[model samples]
Structure formats: C-alpha cells, structure tokens
Target: MDGAGSGVWNDGSVHVDDQVGQGVSADLAAFLRNADDDRPVKIVSSVCGECGGRVFVVLVDDVEGGAERVCTGCGGRAFIADSAEFWGEADPGEAGCPCGGGEFETAVTFSLAADGPVRWVTVGLRCEQDGLCGIYVDWKIDYGPTDHLLALA
Candidate 1:
C-alpha cells in the first residue's frame, strides 16, 4: 500500500496491466531512452505555488510527460486523480519541456513488470539528476479501462 497513491495503480491494487500488447514497444522504447540518458529535467510541483502538480521527464533523447497527485488539504499522495478533488495544476512550459533551462547530465532507471499469462506491464522509474539529485516514478496500469493517461501532463 506504500506506492498505492503514487500513480502506481488504478484499481487500488499493486498490480497494473495496461502497457501490454502493441503499446508495449513504444512504452519500452521510451523507458529505455529514459534509462540510458543522463539529463536534467524539470518537475513541476503541485504544492510549490505552480497551481497544480505537473511532472515532466527529460532524458538524453527526448522528453516525456508525467503526473503526480496528492490530497489537496493533507498533501497525502492521492492514488486517483478524481479522489483528490483538485486538478488545477497545469504545465506552463513548452510541449513537454520546461520554459528555459539547459539540459544537465542525468541518468534514470526504467523498469517494466508483467505477471501471469496476461503479460501485463507496469512501469517503474528512478532517475538521478546531475549525480546529485535522485527521485523515482512508480506507476501501474489497468487493462479493463484502457484510457490510462498518467504520462500526460
């Protein structure tokens, strides 16, 4: 239950199964690109007076989108976007990249997990920024409702 609210799951369970099938290639490609690169990316904090929480991932190849939700009042991690009752946070930068910042050297780990005969895929992300800062992004997917949009900022 520790990562339950960190964009790691949709069905309130630890297992997520959405990144399978044809989409797996793209997801894996993105993951690999993120893991192999060492570049400084910007993460827009929801509680940092930027209106809402917007997560932006940067790598040596390209930039991708990410999201993080927390309880509006308590600041506790909110598993579902609707569960938090607050969605005002929006990105103020250009298409997936921050406004004005030089890309710094950074490296990240992108992992995928699948279980049983279903071969479901869940993405786990950990990044090191400029060899000084470090953070992780954990996420899960649900195939029942295949409209998962955690990667969208």
Candidate 2:
C-alpha cells in the first residue's frame, strides 16, 4: 500500500502517481481517507494530447489540487480544478462477501477540469469486497463525446 493519508489530496481529491486519481470522489473520499494497506485504491485518467499522443494514466496519485496534466510528450497540459465529480456504486457481483465466495464491485468517477484540447476525463474504480478489482479512466476531448474542439492550448 502507498501510505494511508498519502494517497488522498488535502482538497479532498485522491492523488495517485502521475497516473492515479486522488480520492476526491464523493463515495470513495471517506473510504479512501480511511483505507488501509490491504485495501488499496487509486484514480486513473485517460488523456489525449494536442499532438495526437495519448497519455494513458494507469494510476494518478501524485497530483495535488489545482495542478493539471501536462503532456510530457507534446506540451499539452491538464489542470486540476477546484472540484471534480466523484461517484460510486455497490452491486451484488461487485462487492462480494467476506467469506471469499462472493463478488462485489465499487466504482469511482474522477472528473478532471476542462482545458485546451483535453477537456475532462472520467475514471472509474471497480472492485470486489474481497479486494479483487480493476480501474479505468477514459479522456473526453470535449464536454460531449462528439463535441468540437474550441482551442489548441
């Protein structure tokens, strides 16, 4: 495990390495703040740069509040806004029983701030009560998936 409070941002958003989502989401904030070593969780992000390169953040835990993602590859940048949306879900096949016989899922949506060619990314954290899980974060260049790009910043 990375460190208890070390994984969460002071502004409430969870921080992963250059690739993880800070546990700022609503449902996972509390869980993230109080999570232990065995129960590890982090936010991820998908970013598309202006130069046509993709920075697929497998885990984003190093970013602090107000900081954006800068395309190390193309000079593209992403800034973390004052706030982001965080949602979670508990389903039967997701959060399994403690007996290691069932499976359960928990998801978290990390909404990044909009800027330049990269608008925002929604990342999900899925897991089983038994601690089995997966993570996904896809970047949306515009507000709408089909929306147009306004600038090249």
Candidate 3:
C-alpha cells in the first residue's frame, strides 16, 4: 500500500501491513492480506450476539482503564475485561491525539481462514474529539471454531 503513513511488518510468522488515514476498510485489507499465510490469527465479531445486530458503538478510555463494544440494537455490551488477554500484551496506556483527547471511537476487523475460522484481528481507533485515527491493538488467535471468539468482540 502506497500512502503517507503506510507500513508493513513481517516477523517470519506474522505479517501486518496498514495505512493510516485510509479508514477502516484499509485496516481490514491489511489484516486480510495475510489471512492465507501459515501463521496463526484471531478475530472479533461485528455481529452482536444478543440481537444479531451488526452495528455497534465502540468506546475506549485508556486512562480510565475501560473499553467496550455496545450493540445499538439491543444495547448489549462486550467488555474489555471479558477478554483481557485476547487484546494482547500491548496497552495503549497514554495513547491519544496531539489534541490531548483520551476518548476514542473504535472499529474492529477480522482475518479469516479459508476454512471459516478467524486468523487475525485488528482494532482501529479514532479520536472522538479530534478525528485522529490509528490502530489500537491487534493479535493472533491460535484456538477457535470462531463462535466463541466472535462473542468476545
């Protein structure tokens, strides 16, 4: 991907390529590009388990130590604490826009294997106060039929 803030990282097992400022679709492309590789991957659901709604309002407050994905249809919620380790070891502890906003609007993308299991997951965050965008977290999933993993998102 040729873009101002595009980059690719390959560590022999995992390959991540992303472009900043290109929106969620681009981020999803980055994750999908490596889906067929032999490396393990993970996924987060867009479908709400409660009402099967695909729409969600995501919120993340790193400083306050909270994050969640709320389904708009049934007001169902999935919390970060529910899948803490699935979020990986990295923390967006002080991550914020230059405008100093701590809140963010979140979007998630998943990479799936040809066999229907998820291979990877990417979480993209945009500053709710200033419109700044960047990736927040991403991790590979080694275990799943994907149903359990989807419910976690």
By lDDT, the best candidate is: 3
Best by TM-score: 3
Cand. 1 Cα-lDDT: 0.26
Residue 17 CA error for candidate 2 (Å)?
Answer: 17
Show the lowest summed lDDT stretch of 10 residues, model 1. 39-48
lDDT of 2 by residue, 61-142 (tens): 3232122333435655443221122112211122223355232222233333322222443333323334433332334333
1 versus 3: better lDDT goes to: 3
Give me the runs in candidate 3 sitting further than 4 Å from their true place. 1-77, 80-82, 85-94
What C-alpha lDDT does candidate 3 achieve relative to the native structure?
A: 0.49
lDDT of 3 at 149: 52
**Model 1 error, position 90 (Å):** 21
Instruction: List, residue by residue over 46-73, the lDDT tens digit for candidate 1.
Output: 2212333222233211112233332233
lDDT of 2: 0.31
Q: Deviation in angstroms for 145 in model 3? A: 1.4
Where's the lowest-lDDT run of ten residues in candidate 2?
86-95
TM-score (all chains, Cα) for each model: 0.21, 0.25, 0.46
Decreasing lDDT order of the candidates: 3, 2, 1
